[model samples]
Target: MPFRIFRRVLQLVLCANALRVYLISHSIRRVIIATLGTALLLQVAYFASVLLLVWRAWCNRRAVEGTSQRRRGSDYS
Candidate 1:
């Protein structure tokens, strides 16, 4: 099973490399432009997702801290 999986993955890598070569040879300019656009969009999406997750985590942490502070204040009283 592991050998089969490795063989399949290797095949896919070879096929992808062949297709990349063909694309680059066919129209390098268009390929470069498209690749850059795709990379930029991917980076923007990744950063936005990360920022949103961090914001949510920060909010949750702040809320937990606020609740703990209230509990401590009540305990002191």
Candidate 2:
């Protein structure tokens, strides 16, 4: 009977250890996924900022060209 009890205790210990390992692995997987998500968001933001800068530059060039054209028209008049 004592041997049987010993075997039961050993089984319980093994089960508990397995549960702990599974939980740890699950948490690690979540951390990795979150990190990847953050990296992707940052990449998207960087691209957006670059696009905004290009748009601003284009607008400024157009404005300058328009002013220069108006000046030339006035001079002709």
Candidate 3:
């Protein structure tokens, strides 16, 4: 019974090692790297869009302020 238990333990260890090796194979590594890179790219794009929106709002605010100043100056003249 002890020998049978030892055999089972050894089989489990071998199976675990095989799984580990398969996970660390080149194709799997490439898939993991690609997934991470795509995620990073998406994050950057989201930030870029947020930055663009803020920039547009700032420009619009500046334009409105400039127009108001022009109107006030024209009224004084």
Q: What TM-score does prediction 3 earn? A: 0.63
**CA lDDT, candidate 1, residue 42:** 51
- Per-model C-alpha lDDT, please? 0.70, 0.69, 0.69
Clashes of each: 0, 0, 0
- Among all windows of 10 consecutive residues in model 1, the one with the lowest summed lDDT is 9-18
- Write candidate 1's Cα lDDT for 1-77 as tens digits: 25576457655654565568556688766656655665566557657877998999999999999999999999999
Candidate 2, residues 1-77, lDDT tens digits: the string is 25577457655654565556557776756555655565566557657877998999999999999999999999989
**Residue 50 displacement in candidate 1 (angstroms):** 1.1
Query: Candidate 2, which ten residues in sequence have the lowest lDDT sum?
Result: 13-22
Best by TM-score: 2
- TM-score of each model, paired residue for residue: 0.63, 0.65, 0.63
Q: Candidate 3 at residue 50, lDDT?
A: 75
TM-score of 1: 0.63
Candidate 3, residues 1-77: lDDT per residue as tens digits? Answer: 25576457655654565455557774756555555565566557657877998999999999999999999999999
